[model samples]
Target: MRIPGVPPAELAELNRAQDRLSFVYLERCVIHRDANAITATDEKGVVHIPAATLGVLMLGPGTSVTQQAMMLLADNGATAVWVGEQGVRYYAHGRTLARSSRLIVAQAAAVSHRDRRLDVARAMYRMRFPDEADTRALTMQQLRGREGARVRRCYREHAERTGIGWQNRTYDPEDFDSGDPVNQALSAAHACLYGIVHAVIVALGASPALGFVHTGNERSFVYDIADLYKAEVTIPVAFDVAASGSTDIGSDTRRAVRDRAHDGAILHRCVRDIRALLLQPGAAGPIDEAWLDEDAGDDTLRLWDDDGAELASGRNYAGEVDF
Candidate 1:
């Protein structure tokens, strides 16, 4: 997914060269070129993207392009265009633009909050350590105590509820070693959260760094959003799937662990939950328009209008391309 806010300055044009597009992250075997092919690089040293398969290149503001690249891009189906941090401003090819002040405001109001998400994360963590006397059923709100009694209660209860075998023991964060059941569950929870957040980032079309809730220099906006769904979806399923896959919850279980997180129904529910979260008023907020703008938005992001039309509000939309 793309970020909602653009960088403060113009992107640096590092280089431009011609290369045949082979499929990597390419979702489909389609490609387009706009006038001059410009290669942009962020300060983070991540390579800037070239034209994408099945996606039209929308030039940003102050963007320079050659007529030849533009002709090839448009003719080859660079569906629409966007200008600067704003959004889709034009349809250089056979595409349309959409967006409005009301829409932006609505989208900004729909993302979820940190405290609630942390609560959910804590819950998932407890489920994984069900048999531990010091870590189950504890909410983040109650995690501040040095004794961690609340967490212990939750863990004991979790063990009882799941009827799982466990060593009734106190969890000392320091005493834990690799491949311990508790640690394994926690790792799975983290991975599941990562996958879910990545999916959410893809859906929202917002930069994972420009987040609504979790914040830090090490920004993983995708991880933050996905954290919200872990307790509700990913964590539980991961545990069950992992246990079912192997008696030992170790590296051998990682694939099953990842697979449950990626299960179609679970992922779909997570996506639906994210969409619902983002659409709520001031909870998660509405979808960002920049996410849908061909210039700034990730083309994979999908938005719907009140009229049930599959389009980004106020930004022109190309026909839907199912992943």
Candidate 2:
């Protein structure tokens, strides 16, 4: 895929360093490709979103996006996610950054190996509670208990500081309308955090279905990564937004979470954390084209002709055909 203005070298650099891009969230807008830019139009006016420089685009309720805009996003390595109100629910996701899938292989290996998987899980717990003395000795059950207690304390502290009534989190997906404003706000904030974490996980080519701290479901890994940042980012933001008594609690919470994410450089932190957790120290460096070609055998590889049709023989560019 040829990106129009950017040269090949610069484009490669941009694709490799997507961790530096900022994240944008859009709701109730129409997104379309305008020349080389992705333009979003709302009742107010049209605004150009720098898709290439975006890590994630959260498309919330009432968002309509054109195919061309999606293609542009895919070409530029930006992830687009369809979400519910204030990003409280994830509906779907677009194409991920087409880089090497070595990270995915490594992640799968780590998660599938019983001993290493436990180590990775412990690493995740240690990251969440850095002050914990001995994460290595704690079983998954003990870790869960500690995490639950820590989260409860975070809720209590935030509620006290923001003067919002502290209540157990209660939300009915079937009837979000009937849920408490505080619960709704908390859900919204956590959703944004999850979206961001999910995008980073996908960009790194890691399987979201595989998780260490969290297990089961499609977004288990996403939940695990988002938990690392919840107390610092979403928890407080939720409380503050709810305390403000805003009529649009969900929108207010999402906006505050976005601001906090930007201020905290959460995407960069997520990237660093994922690398640290998944990749062992002194592991082989980033996978290269040669490594990928060697790993993908001839039977699994497909050779394409110039007209976008697959050739009969499974051959690569070297012209040394494999039958």
Candidate 3:
């Protein structure tokens, strides 16, 4: 009944999504389980983190994590991500807390159907450009064009405002340092955003690859969702970091992005927006506010009924329906 390291210990009991921490980044440390908390020890010293409330544990370059630490994280429904060597790229991640297939099922249904896929893409565009009242009628190519122009204008405006150099948005995933300061900052900021969005998508039992706006890549849906906030979250931050002339652009950009995301209440809004996108259509009505607080591993399974209602699962209905 008690959560491990969080004060008063109430995570496993209540499992409130907002009660958890957004993320914690650790590098060049040996991480292991210490009592109810996780300990990260380095030449700098040792720090203890509340594993119960941790959402994503980003293990960066020169980091070593013990199996005991990983087990503790898994038990507490925490996500552990192994990041890039210089720490600006995403590599892999540990398990998510999702046990229900409701969101993923909805996502698959929408992605498989052509009209539903376009509708989801339009909904995303609407979320990005809330002022635009005619996104519903825009074709995919038109939507892309609008988005491209908007992003270009955003970059130009930010560059002018900050007095920072901006030629174009270019990132070499294989080499994070090949780009200039602004580009490096942008890449780092976006990686952080991608990590957060990917964490949320998997936590809600949605496929990060089955995207509506993007495709082919393993994290296509992560890109789709992260693009929703790039203009407001990462673009300006990257430019501002470059303007400050920070020697360590990656670290500074990440800190700025983290602060902005927190101040903007992005985590809460991310969950709410994801639910609005995937869980709305084919439902009886709008989802309640309490759905945002759903605990991982609730484990309710139902048969997908294309006709209407949710049928009971774990039964043979071969004789009841047609082939």
Candidate 4:
């Protein structure tokens, strides 16, 4: 769900639509899909399509497309078509579909970036736990003494878990050392969990790649959300399960861990924190003291602190609508 080089505000507007049938994330392939005589085509080098409304989604270079299933999408008045690795150069009937796709891309981008603050927290969580901490606390020269030491302690505790390895930490991607069985297993598990996060984000009508904390290169905001639960959920569960002699992330174990995370209050706490951050008067844009009272509806919604105390009650939305 990443289309780089596009403006966040424009993307946010498109995402607010609740009735769109489907969206495309064509970052690597050219795609085409059709529904009710409406077809959209996404081509090379274009992150936002400016044509067609409902027919086809064409993927070229640097793009991706997602749907529950190809047949399902087509039946639902949509089509998912890919043009392979080399990328597509031409389509049978191009202009019409391309125009529609542009509009779709705009709307999709807006929806995807709707929750920037949640994106940030999720990314922070991922970079900190469950995914091996590559940097040693003591080794980071810039870190203050106490901060460095505390980070190291946490890192060591997390590193001891199974499915935690030292590939990115110690070796280059081109190096053969990355093939170690332990590292491979860790990578595989992390990948599966990442996918689960992506599915969750998609279900929530949120973008999976755009993030508040991580750079654009990572292309996995969902991975960030999954990372947040690492310390609070994934890492602990993984270590305990593995310590008991289970190594693989079998379907049952994966489901169990996911359910535990879902039911756990920590994630909710983090989400609430994120929501509050979003509600901050000046967080989205500039703060307007006069508009605060009128912006947030009175008593219709209430936000409690960790101790369950009311904070602020005035709505001050500015930049874009909340989804």
Best by TM-score: 3
Task: Note the Cα lDDT for every prediction shown.
Answer: 0.39, 0.77, 0.81, 0.37
Best prediction by lDDT? 3
**TM-score between model 3 and native:** 0.86
Which has the higher lDDT value, candidate number 2 or candidate number 3? 3
Q: Please, what are the lDDT tens digits per residue for candidate 1 over residues 1-323?
A: 87663222211221101111211121112222323343333334323344322132434445444454444333332233432221112212222112223323333443244554543344333333445455334545554452245435644555555555545443333332334464455454454345334433332333445444455623345555554454444445434544454555533334444455445444444444444443333332334543333233233445766876665456644555454
CA shift at 75, candidate 1, in angstroms? 17
Residues 55-123, candidate 3, lDDT per residue (tens digit)? Answer: 778889999999889887877777888888545777888876666777887889999998888888988
Cα-based TM-score, every candidate: 0.37, 0.83, 0.86, 0.37
Candidate 3, residue 94: lDDT: 82
Q: Could you give the candidate ranking by TM-score, starting with the highest? A: 3, 2, 1, 4
> What is the C-alpha lDDT profile of model 2 across 180-201, one tens digit per residue?
8889888888888888888888
In candidate 3 the C-alpha lDDT for residue 78 amounts to 76
Question: Which residue runs does candidate 3 get wrong by more than 4 Å?
Answer: 1-15, 282-298, 301-323
Best-to-worst lDDT order: 3, 2, 1, 4
- For 113-173, candidate 4 gives per-residue lDDT tens digits of 6454433343343234425442232222332343335445654576665445433323223
